[model samples]
Target: MKKIAILLALSVALSAPAWAATKAVTLSISGMTCGVCPITVRTALQRVPGVEKVGIDEAKKQVTITYDYSKTNVQALTRATKDAGYPSSIKQGERDHG
Candidate 1:
């Protein structure tokens, strides 16, 4: 029973990170009509909990965000942008970033 308990504890510890993993993805944003638009979008994404990094491409109307999956998800991201008056969507087929 002691060995079994030890193995179970080890397994739980190893799997914890996977459960709260980080994910990065590119989001297509709309309503960015000028140079200052990226700043607004960036602020919106940054306010989300677990958001680590934000990269904005005004020309492409896209923003890439890295965040902890356990704290936030794509829905939260989109909602933040929308609430900030810039609606966004996840770009299809764009895999998670490093």
Candidate 2:
């Protein structure tokens, strides 16, 4: 009986749903000339409910955003960047910096 109870508890633990963390995407932005640009991008992305973190590389002109996909998507993120005065695009490959 003890062995059967242990097996049942183990099965219950294994079947429990795991909490998934947010996923990140990097976007290549254009026309960011100064410090304010990164702030603008961060602000816009933060408006999304599940956006956990944002990192901007001014030299590379890229924004790395970690967000919950269940709450937002790539299009939404790109739009946020555009609305912030720094238009952006998803980096597809090794492309020229803009």
- Strongest candidate by TM-score: 1
The C-alpha TM-scores of every prediction are: 0.74, 0.72
Task: Estimate the overall C-alpha local distance difference test score of candidate 2.
Answer: 0.80
Q: Specify the poorest-scoring 10-residue window by lDDT in model 1.
A: 89-98
- Give one digit per residue, the lDDT tens place, for model 1 in 1-98: 99999999999999987677788989988688899889988988898998989999888899999999888888899999999899888887776664
What's model 1's lDDT at 3?
Answer: 100
Every candidate's CA RMSD = 3.9, 5.8
Candidate 2 matches the true fold with a TM-score of 0.72
Q: How much is 74 displaced in model 1, in angstroms?
A: 0.3
Cα-lDDT of candidate 1:
0.88
Query: What is the C-alpha local distance difference test score of each model?
Result: 0.88, 0.80
